[model samples]
Target: MSSIEGRHPDRNLINMPMKQNLVKEKHDASLHLISRDFETCIDVCQKALHVLSSTVDLQQASDHQEEMEEFIVIIVQAYAELDRWQEVLPCITQHYSGIENVSPNVLKVCLLLHAKVQEFSTCSALYNIWTSSREGREVNDSDLEMLLDIYVTQTLLQAGKSSQITEVVQSSQLSQDTKERLIATYSELVRETQLAEETASTTALPDLAHPQNIVDRVVAKGLRALRMMLMWIWSVRPRLSTRTLYSLGGLATLLIIATQGFDTSNRTLEILGNLMEHFIRSKR
Candidate 1:
């Protein structure tokens, strides 16, 4: 069945309210659709989009500029869920340019969705707009930093390009905290890659009769070592200012510890060890 039949018919009808009631009703209707039938969700979303598009219509006698800006956000969110990222990008770009009184919440949502679809070029363009705008000065939200970091990291890893990654790390605009997190993530990836290479070079089979050859022993040792190091670092993280250097040292230490002991606990250890073994085999 179509999702629209489940939604309230009246909610789809838009009327101009001089006060904030128009935006509130629209928000409420959108939320209602979310809680009910998924199909009905689309109808409410399209209605919100219609409200936004019509406000700018030349035929309209009065332009409700602020209300239109508010409704655009609702539409953007709906398009995101449908994975119509292409549609969202233009709407966001237009809003970013045309709206003088746009909120940070709106800009944040646009940036986040743009990042999710791997529209790095568009994100760069929007970033330029945001940085130059007077409103841009207040864009201190962490979500934006996280989205950009993830996009840049994934793009670099997939393309096997380190120069751009290094550039981003050295860039003065990125906060020290975000830079440190990215460095740690990158370091972990490098360690995993090296471990994979080492495993590929070794072909000697471990004796099953030997306790160390048992799956549980290896995983237990790895997890215990990892947990201890993670706890120690997390505890010290607040006090440390040299995040990138500290994270590199911590990961190196953890890698060393992971290679040391192999004491088994239960089936969980066996499962993890078997998983690692499978990973090793697949790499070959």
Candidate 2:
């Protein structure tokens, strides 16, 4: 009896290490399967999907469903890296019914890629799935806030809808800290766009300014001056309130029109000069 009892404990101890080894092996295999080549990755993902859909075995179906979602993320990343957006879009659309099961990390990567490629239409579609998905519900509020910020910013920038951008940035749900960061990003983008427009206009103006053409020279010079003034306004506009900026802009427009007709009357010139002085002071 004593010998039998001693052997029983020894046997249990021996089996514990084997069980641990098997668990480790299973984990290693899953990782290996995920890291395999593209063809192999697709094969694995498809096999997982097949098992999930056809299997009547509850345990097997549940396990395979989890594995399939993980592998789908891997395959999607692979497609994105190759810039095979066409393939990625279809695959996402077809399997998107299961997106609630997809990991947030994978969702973030997909959203970012869509944003980068200027796929606003796709991004908008995916955002609906994302907002309604179980995984999206599982996301922390702070994370959701950040994701919304990124989406709105990219969408507005791509669409050139500055008004919408301002509306989104003003949301009370957005944290103050994030609001400040987004404001800075918006300001930077505005500056860059203004600079690009100025550069293009400058490059095109030289063709219109010729030595032998008096009319063309005058027109080009006037256009150049107008562009310079616009640049000045764009640079300073963000620093002031919208109301103040609009008032100043209107004043400048009226002065330009009044002076354009060669009105040298004392009252007209004095009014134009006073408006110009106000515009200059506002810049300071």
Candidate 3:
């Protein structure tokens, strides 16, 4: 009984000073955080962490785990406020899972930080967890708008990665506002991509029959435009209207007249023959 009692008191004596120092350190750290002295807060936390490491007692470490976790949360906020997003990633990945109940505000900031760094996948997972957390916080318009804007600004606007956001759109329980914004974004992208495709597949031609186009373009861009028109007709023959077919007759005649001595006889004849075949098929 005497020996056991002696050991317990000795252990308490050894652990007690560290406990007092930890409390003081945390108090100072809290003050630093409140004052926006972020770097100093981190420094105080690190110092306390070193003390915990030196103790190396599993029970002691477990007892103070909550304190350390709080410190890490502050550090994460500090990093985010400083715009050191890359650093926030490792801190979150390391400390986040160990936390039993995460603060919604902090998690929201994490999501936003991931977005700032273009970490789309990471941002998505954090967003799902934050919005779906057991805390039962209602997702406000600002939250929904933030996620949508993240996709629009980072993914679609920058890399044209609309396909990447499809899974999020389908899986997430979005608000009507978000859905509407997504619809608008989708329309914008479709208009843009369609325009790009048209530009690539056809030469931009004003009406060749127009007096101005005939003047400005006939010599400068006429032959190029005619070849594009012929290719366009050939490509869309199955869906061609009679008017478009007649339109092609004009293009074919122009092409033959323009390129007669340009060493393109075989190809020109092939195009003319294809047009004749199409006319015969239409008549039949």
- Give the number of the best model, judged by TM-score: 2
**Cα TM-score per model:** 0.41, 0.45, 0.36
List model 1 lDDT by residue over 59-136, tens digit each.
222234455555666677667766776876566545444423345556556656776676666655654455446433
Which 10 residues in a row give candidate 1 its minimum summed lDDT?
56-65
Q: Rank the candidates by lDDT, best first.
A: 3, 2, 1
Pairing residues by index, what is the TM-score of model 2?
0.45
Candidate 3 residue-wise lDDT, 1-284, digit = tens: 34533555433222567677777888888888889898887788767755544553422333555555566667766676677677765654444442223444456566556666677776656666655563344556565556555555555545556665555554445665667667677768757877887997676564674564454344334445555665566567756666766766666566656644344445455655665565657545
Poorly placed runs, candidate 1 (over 4 Å):
1-20, 32-73, 98-144, 153-155, 158-162, 175-185, 190-284
Clash count for candidate 2 is 0
**Residue ranges of candidate 2 with Cα displaced over 4 Å:** 1-40, 49-70, 81-84, 93-102, 132-138, 170-173, 204-284
* lDDT of model number 1: 0.54
lDDT of 1 at 148: 51
